[model samples]
Structures are given as C-alpha cells and as structure tokens.
Target: MKIELLAPTSAALPTLVVAAGERASVRFLEFFASAIRNPHTRRAYARAAGDFLAWCAGAGASSITAVQPLHVASWVELQTQTHSAPTVKQRLAAIRHLFDWLVTGQIVPHNPAASVRGPSHTTNKGKTPVLDATEARQLLDSIDVSTPIGLRDRALIALMVFSFARIGAALAMRGEDVYVQQRRLWVRLREKGGKTHAMPCHHTLEAYLHAYLEGTGIADDPRGPLFRTVARGTGQLSDTPLPQANAYAMVRRRAFVAGIGTKIGNHTFRATGITAYLKNGGTLENAAAMANHASTRTTQLYDRRRDEISLDEVERILV
Candidate 1:
C-alpha cells in the first residue's frame, strides 16, 4: 500500500504536486520503495515523514524549498528526547532522502538535511532476554497436551526454540511449508528481508507436529495456515493465521503457566536458541548462518560470553 504525505504549497510559489506525474519524484519513490520492501520499513518512513511535515507546518515552511538545516536539526533534537539515537538517525536519513528527491525534481534548491547530525548511542548493550535450558523445559511441561490447542501450542514453541524463527515468520508459515523427507521433517521458513530458509525438525518436534495435524484435522492444502485457532463454540479450526501479537500472548501465557516470573517473549526463544547452539560447541559462523545474520558481530551478541568454556586457568591467579 502506498502512503502519501501532503504539504501545502506556498501561494507565491507554483502549486507543484510532489507525487503527481513528476518523473524525478516517481523515480525517487520507486527507488526508496524498492530499497525497503519490509512493512516495518514502510511504517517507519511514513511516521518520519509525518513528523517532518508537522515540523514544517510549525516553522511556516509551506513548500519543500523553504526548509532549512536549522529546522531539520530542531526536529532531530525533538525526536531524540523520546526515541533512541539509532531511531533518530534513521529518521534523519529518511528526511535527507526526501529532500534529495525534492532537489532532484527542481522543487527545492538543495537538500537542507544533508549535513544534519544524529544522536549517538552505545552499540554493545544486549536487549533480548534468553531462556535457560531449565526454563525451556518448564515452558514445555506447563502445557496440557491432552487438549488439541495445548498440543498445537507445544508444537509451535518447539518450532520457535529449535528453528529460531521470528514470530512473524512463524505465523506467516503455511501447511505446505512442512514436509517429510528421508524420515525427517523439514520446515520451510519465509524469513524477513525476503529470504527463504529451511530448518530440520528434531524427533520431538516431529512427534508433536504429527499429533497436532492429526488431532486438528488441518488440511494438507499448501496455502492454508500451518497454525489456526479452533472455534470456541464449534471446536473447528479456522484457517486464519495467528497474528504477531497473538504469538507473543501465547508465549506470555506459557511463561505464567511454567511459573517463570521473568518477562519472557517471542525474542527470548531466538536468543535462547542461538545461545544453546553455541554452548553445545557450535561455531559462530554456523550460528550466524542459521540466524540469517549478515555479520557474525550480530550473532555474537546472542552468545553468552560470560560463561567461557575454556579449561585454562592458573591456580594462583584463580585463588
């Protein structure tokens, strides 16, 4: 879906519709859209543009030509009070690109936000919480497998922990994505950033999945949702896929059932899976590849660096 931001043009200036039949504006929009195909990126850009235009209104700048570096700097400062430095920087980048479009289209003299500076922040702080092995076991044991919904939830948790899939990817998955080959179940994941990944299902997951499929009687239709909500009244599973918020709620519910007082969420599984793999002698390179991270640095943050597996220690120094 295309989002439009309309800023009133000055009466003294020619009424130029930025996104209407303008070759440069069209090209710029196409390039920006292509660079960011993810829905999150689109939402971020829409918000940033809204803030910039609102600022423009307050500053008495009706047209793109009236914007100045000071106005851009002021907006950055205002955003920094509520958002992180990286977020502020992202907003600045969006504004810069918008002005560049204006400049290229001859709607503005130059890009005023070109030299606008963004706030700085620490890059090494770990934010995602991870579950230990005990916690993982407790979460699984908390579910009542006697019920069909409980069985389905157990299978979903197993997939998240084993495959390290993002909640969105898990919810977006369809029945056809699961297939049996060579006596092993393979799950096809439609990952973020438009990438496809395959993860091997362990025996435990395979058993749980089999139970869920048979109990729910979910069709083998390739396009149907892999997981669905069984109607409360009729006890029939609906084909609608679960939403991301629903996935988080499921995790929270499981955490409560397991007596885990800590704040566990969908991201916890991702970090826990990566940490468990590495602690079991998996290499950083392989972990990075599995996580689909472009750099090992991103994956390193997920590893528990405090618990070193080294055997070397001087007795005197240790004392």
Candidate 2:
C-alpha cells in the first residue's frame, strides 16, 4: 500500500494524501517541511510514515485522527518479521515522532505511537567493513597518482583514513576549508548537526592533500569545491562538485583494481582509521573527540581492536 507521488515534476515534493479526507493531510505534509531538519532523516521518516498510513488506510482506519495505539503496535509487530531489529526500531521511531509532531500541531488528538514499543536492539560493534592496517596501507599505496583523477582519488581516501572523516563531511569541503594553521595543514569539517569540527591533518594526509591541491591547480580557487567531478572528454576535473554516488563508484573501482575484495563503503575508512588509532594506545575519549562523536559509546562501535583477539581465538578451534 505504498503511496506513489501523484505529481511527477519533482519526486521529493510529491503530494501524499495520508488521511481519509484530503483536508487532514496538511499537518502531515507540514510535519516533514518544518519539523525535520536533516534531509536523510526527513526522507526516511516520510517513507516510514507513508508506508504506515497506507497500511492503516487498508486496515479500515477512517482517518489520521482514527489511528490508535493498537494500529501502531500491529504494524511494528508486522515489521519485526521482515526487517532487522534496528530498522524496525527506526521505522517505529519515525512513526512515533511524526505522530508527536502532529499532536503538538493540533492535527490529532494525541500520539497513537506514544505507548508502542519497538523491537530490542543493542550492539558494541558496527557493520561498516574495515580494512586491516596492512590492507589499508596496501590500498593507499596501490593508487597511481599519475593523473588528476588519480591524485584526487588517493587524497580523498587518505583524508578519510587518516583523519577519520565521514564521507558527507569530506565531500562538503570548500578549498578554503584546507588551510595552514600554526604552519601545519588543518581541515575543517562541517559535520552532522552543522557542527564545525577542525582537525590537524595527519602528516601523511598533509602530503596527499598538497599533491592533490597543487597538481589540480585548484588550490588558488579557495571558494571552489574541494572535490570536483572529472569533466567528460577532458580528462580533468569539472567545476561541479562530486556527488556521493560517484564517490562510492570510484571507491569500488579502486578496491577492485587493488585486488582487495571486502565489500566496503565510504564509512570503511572511518572505522579503519579509528581501529588503527585505538590499536596504537589512543583513548576512547580522544577517538570520540577526533571522530566528532557526542558519546564514547558511538566511538566504541568503530573500535575493532577486539576483532584481532576474536580472530586469534578462532584459530585455536582446529577443524
């Protein structure tokens, strides 16, 4: 019962009629437009809400106002059968928060999801595939820096691994974000929640950055995007900023060429960097600070030092 956007002009701005009558959908639309600030969160919540409301409509609920705690519980229970615990919990949170927004806006009597409990989930480890120290070094050294694209690729990957930068923050940088502070290169990241995080570049990262910047000749264009798309037919970077999808594709290609076959994504470097740091006697608090995490618990997920111990123990069980 997924609702398809009636208007095709812009997929994101689709008119979704959630309630029974068209009139009750105003608050539903406004909830996403005004209440949600993060685009990723907004998109996810909208999908969850849309899916739930469509289900409710099929379940004979009259309108948004008629949605009850029973309906929320029923949907949540259904989700548990097909989705992972974390995903179920996230979807439930989306519903609960949306209803809360509607309640405060006077669109509904009360939140239907207020008492609903999501599935239980807890983990000390994250799922991001990380490279070992040797593998990480091999991957970095494998990149040939003969072309502008090659230089850019090596630098971008090094930045993430050395500085523990999130992909979004790394791509969002302007050329000016890389600057000389106290005669050493430093990077400024506009991280999640719009927090400005600044970290001194690792000496290796500094070398890669200098190579990319100087080789590209875009260093003087301080206001231009730090990472640019390779222009079609020119074998050089275009003025347009590199998109996240393109970055992912480049990473996959590089990994494949390097003959390393662990299914990795952008977050792989961040986890690899943190694990490397912690293995060298770095503290959890310092790792949290470097990774711009609000809590050490989140930082702990990236610490894969325990992974080595687990591997060593597994060798004892001879088949």
Best by TM-score: 2
- Model 1, runs deviating above 4 Å: 1-35, 104-106, 305-319
Candidate 2: tens digits of C-alpha lDDT, residues 181-259: 9999999999999999999999999999999999999798999999999999999999899999999999998999888
Q: What is the C-alpha lDDT of each candidate?
A: 0.75, 0.88
Q: Write the per-residue lDDT of candidate 1 for residues 252-277, one digit (tens) a residue.
A: 98899889987988888877888888
TM-score of 1: 0.83
Alpha carbon lDDT at 257, candidate 2:
89
